[model samples]
Target chain A: MFSPLIEDLIRALRCLPGVGPKSAQRMAMYLLEKDRDAAGLLASSLQQAVEKVGRCSRCRTLTEQDVCSLCHNPRRDHTLLCVVETPADVLAIEQAGNYHGLYFVLHGHLSPIDGVGPADLGLDLLGERLGEQVEQGISELIIATNPTVEGEATAQFIAERARAKGVAVSRIAHGVPIGGELEYIDGGTLAHAFNSRTVL
Target chain B: MFSPLIEDLIRALRCLPGVGPKSAQRMAMYLLEKDRDAAGLLASSLQQAVEKVGRCSRCRTLTEQDVCSLCHNPRRDHTLLCVVETPADVLAIEQAGNYHGLYFVLHGHLSPIDGVGPADLGLDLLGERLGEQVEQGISELIIATNPTVEGEATAQFIAERARAKGVAVSRIAHGVPIGGELEYIDGGTLAHAFNSRTVL
Candidate 1:
C-alpha cells in the first residue's frame, strides 16, 4: 500500500506485461522516490516510440518510417533475409551481430486457433517481394523461429510456402544455449536433435 | 528478440524495480502487440505522474502538493502520529485501513553498512515533529517499520526517542501471513516466531 497517488500510479503501471500486483507497487514506489528522472524519461520514450515508430512497408520490421533502418542500410545484405515472428525477435537477433542480412517481421504466427492463416501473414505480398528480390540475386532465407512448438510449426509453414515460390529456405539450428549445462538440460531427444542439425 | 521500438521500450521498462531482463522484454513486446491501447494509457499516466507528483515537504511522502494527502487531511488525528521508513510502508498501513492518523515518511532505515544513520534518515526532524505532536496532545506514536532487522532497529530507536519525550509508543505485530502454510516453512522456528508475536 502507498499513498492514493502512488497507488494510482502503480495501478497504472500494472498495464505492463508480467508486472503483477506486487511488482507494480514496487515500481511505483521506486519511481516516486529512487529514480524519478529515469521513470519520467521512460514515460516519454513510451509515447514517442508508439507515435513515431511503425512498420517497414516491404519487410514489416518496425521503423520510424515506411522503411526501417535495416531496409534502408546499404551495407546489410538485402539478398539474405531473416524472417522472424515478432519485432522483438528481430532485435534479439540483431543484438548478437552475427547476421548482416535484412529482416522481415511477420508480426504474428499462423495460429488457426486465432483464425490467422498464411494470407493473414501477407505471404502473397511476401512472394511478390521475393520475386522482386530475385532480380537482386537473392539466395538464402533464414527461418529463425524460437524452439517452441508453435515456433516450429510456424517455421515449417513459412518454409513450405517460401519454397513453393522457388526460394531456398533454411532454419537456424535449435540446440542447447551456449552456456547451458546438461544437468539442467531436458536433453532427452533434443540431444539427438542438436546432433542432427541439417539444412532443409 | 523484438523490433527496435519494442526493444527500446523494454529497455526503458527496466527502470522499474523488480523488473529484470526477461520480464521487461516480455512487457515491451506485450505493450506493442497485444495491448497498444493500454500501453498508450500507461505512457500517459507515467508522464502525468512524473510531471505532477512531488514529495510532501514535511514528510517526504509522495503527493501532488508540497504536503502529502495525510499531512493535509484535517480529519486525520494530527496528535496521533505514525512513523514509517518509506512511502511504501505508509501505503501498507493505510491499506490495513484501521489507523486514522497523520504519517511521517523517513524514506529509509538506518543501515550503517550502507552509511545510513540518524541524519541520513532525517531522524532529527522526526524527533522535532514527535515533540510537536506531544505538545498538541498527540499522546500516541505508532512505530510501524517493516519486520526486517533494520526496520526493527529503526522502530526501537524511534520508540526510545518518543518515550523520552513522554509519548506512548506501539509497534505493529508480525506473525504468519493470512494464507500461510506451515509445512513448507523453513526452520522449525517459524512457528516460534508465530507464537512470539509481540505488542509494542
Candidate 2:
C-alpha cells in the first residue's frame, strides 16, 4: 500500500525479535513522518554495530572490542566465573547488581535435537580455561543456566569437566522468586522451592 | 553494561515506536547474534528510505518518485478524493480494498496550540486544486480523518472549504466496528452507532 522504499523499510523492521507487521508499519511511518534525524542515527548505528560487533574472545559475549569490558575489568573477582546461556543473561545479572565475579556466556545450552553440542558452545575453550585455572585464578564455576532439561544436562556436563580439573562447580538455586505469592506460583517452581529449602 | 557500539545500537533502537529499553536490547542481541545479514539489510534499507523518500507532489504521501503511484494511476477515479491525516491512514484504507479514488494526506490535523495552521497542512494547495476542480475533474471530497476532537474539527474545516468551492463533501461514518459487541463497545462508540443507525 506504501511506496517501494517505505515497504522495504517496514519489511526490514520485522527482523527485530518481537516486532510484527503492524508494529513494523507504525515504526516505519513514525520514523519517516516524525523523526528523520532519529531514523538516520538508528541506521548509522545499526550499520556500524553490524560491521564491528563480534564475540568477545574471553567471555563469548557480544562486543566490538576483542575482550569485553566485563571480562577485562580487574576489580571483578576472576576466581568466580558464572556460566550462562546467552549474552542477554550477562546484562540481566549485571542489572540485578549482586554478582561481582566474571561471566562465561555459553550462547546456548546443549540441545541435541537441533544439533547444538559442546563444540558449538565453545566448551573446548572453557575446558582450556578450566585447565589453566591456577594461572587464570579461576577456582569456582557457577552454573547459572536456565533450569530446563537442556540447561540441567549442560550444567552436569560442565560440572564434570570442572571437577576433573580440580575446580569446584556450583549451580545457582532455583525456587520461587522473592515477594512472589505461593498460590500464584507454578507447581514446578513451588516443588523446587520446597525441595531446595535452606535453613536460616 | 554493554560495549560502546552495542550500547549505541541499543540506544538507537529505542527510537522505534513502542520499543523500550528491554525490547531494544533483545532486538539488538537477536540481530547481532542470530542474523547479521538481516541487520545489515535493515540498516541499508532505513538509510536509503530516509535519504530518498519524500512527499508526493500531488497527494503529499511518502514516495521516492516525484508523484506517488496511486496519484499517477490513470484508472483511479479522479472525480473523488479522500483526505486523510497521514500516509498510514491511506495504507489502512487501501488495505480495506474498497476505495478506488485518490488521496490527499494532511500530514497532521490543525492544532492552534501546536501552531499547525491551514498553510502548514498545504491547505492552500488543496484550495487551488478545489478551485480548478472543473479542469481536474474532481466533484466529490471525502473526509476520512480519524474520529477524535481534532480529527472532527479538521474534517469539518475541510468540509466547509470544499463546500465553498462548490464541491460535494462527506465525512466517513463513525460507528461501532463490524465485529464489535455492543456490550463490550465503549459508550462514545455506542452513542455514535445509535446516532448513525441505517434503514437496513
Candidate 3:
C-alpha cells in the first residue's frame, strides 16, 4: 500500500522468522521515519555478513575464517568434543560459560521422517575426527543437542558410533531446569528428574 | 559472542523497534544460516529506500519523486484535503477506502513541551494551499489527526486557521468504535457517543 521501495523493504523483512505483513510494514515505516542511517548500516551489515560469513570447515559453526576462533584456539580442549544441532545452539553453550571443548555442529538433528540421516548431519567428518589416526586422541565426545525426542535419538546414534570407534561418549544430563517451578514442569521432565536423581 | 560480521549484523538489527539483543541475534543467525539470499535482498532494499525515499514536496508524505503519486493524481479530489500526522496514517486512511481526498502530512502534532509548533508542522505551506490565489479552490480541510489531547488541540488550531482563511474545516468524529462493545467502552467515549448520536 506504500511506495515501491517501502513495499519491497516490507516483503524482504519477512525473511526474518515470525515477522508477518503487518509487522514488516511497521518495521519499514519505523526505519524510514526514525533511523534511516541505522537502516543503512543494517543494510550494509547484512550484505557483509552474507558475503563473508560461512561455516567453519572443522565444526560447521558460522565463522569468517575457514577454522573458527574456538576451533583454532590452542587453550580450548581439542581432546574433548561437544556435538550440537545448530550454530545457534553452539552460541547458547558458549554463553553458558561452562564448556571449554571444541564443537561439531550437525546443523540439524536426525529426523527420519524428514530424511535427515547421519550423512546429512556431517557424521562422516565426525567419524574421521574420532578415528585413531593421530597419537594425541580425543578423550570424550559430549552430545549437547536439544533435549527433544529427535535430539535423544540423534545422540544415541552418535554415542553408539563413537563407542564403536573406541572413543568415550556421554549425553548432556536432562532434568528440571535450574530455576524451574515443579508445578509448571511437564510430566516427562519430572520423570527424567526422578530417574536421573543425583546424590548429594 | 559471535564473529565480527555476525556481531555487527546483530547490532544493526537492533535498530528495529522493540527488538532487543536476543531477538537481534536470533534474526541475524536465522538470516545467515537459512536464507542468505533473502538477507541480501533485504540489505539492498534498505539501502535503496534510505537513498531514494524522501518527503513529498507538496504533502510532506514519503515519496521517491518531488511530487508523490497521490498529489500528482488528477482523479483524486484535491479540493478536499485530509490532514494527517504521518505517512503511516496516510496509508491507513487510504487502506480504509472511505475517503478519496488528497492528504497533507503534518509529520507531528503540536507538542509545545517538545518545542513543536505550527512551523514544525509546515502550516505555512498549508496556509498557501488554503489561500485564495489558486484557480481550483479548496472547499474543505479535514482534520484527521488522532484523538489524543495534543491531537484535539492541533485539530482545533487548524480548524480556526482554515476558517479564518475562508476554507471550511471539519474534524473526524470520535466516540465508540464500530466493532467496540458498549460495556468495554470508556466513560468519555460513551458520553461522546450519546452526544453525537445520529438520527437513524
Best by TM-score: 2
What's the lDDT for residue B62 in model 1? 79
Residue-by-residue lDDT tens digits, candidate 3, A33-83: 889999999999998999999888888889888888898898898899999
The alpha-carbon interface RMSD of model 3 comes to 0.9
When sorted by DockQ, best at the front, the candidate numbers are 2, 3, 1
Q: Between the candidate structures 1 and 2, which one is better when assessed by lDDT?
A: 2
List the candidate 2 regions with Cα displacement exceeding 4 Å: A133-136, B133-136, B190-200
Each model's iRMS: 2.5, 0.7, 0.9
Q: Tens digits of per-residue lDDT for model 3 on B1-200?
A: 57888889999999998789889988988898789999999999999999999988889888788888898888888789999998999989999999988899998999999999999999999988889456577899999999899999999999999999999898888899999999999999999889998999
Error of 1 at B137 (Å): 1.9
A1-200: candidate 1 lDDT, tens digit per residue: 34556667777888877678888878877886788788887887789777876767878866667777787788888889888888778878888888998887788887889998878767676777767744475577899877677778989987887787788999987666688876787865467566876788
lDDT of 3 at A1: 53
Question: What's the true lDDT of residue B175 in model 2?
Answer: 92
- Please, what are the lDDT tens digits per residue for candidate 2 over residues A1-200? 78899999999999898989999999999999999999999999999999999899988999999999998998998888999999999988999999999999999999999999999999998988777736567889999999999999999999999899899999998999988999899999999999999999
Clashing pairs for predicted structure model 1, backbone only:
A1-B91, A2-B91, A87-B2, A87-B3, A88-B1, A88-B2, A88-B3, A89-B1, A89-B2, B79-B138
lDDT of each: 0.78, 0.92, 0.90
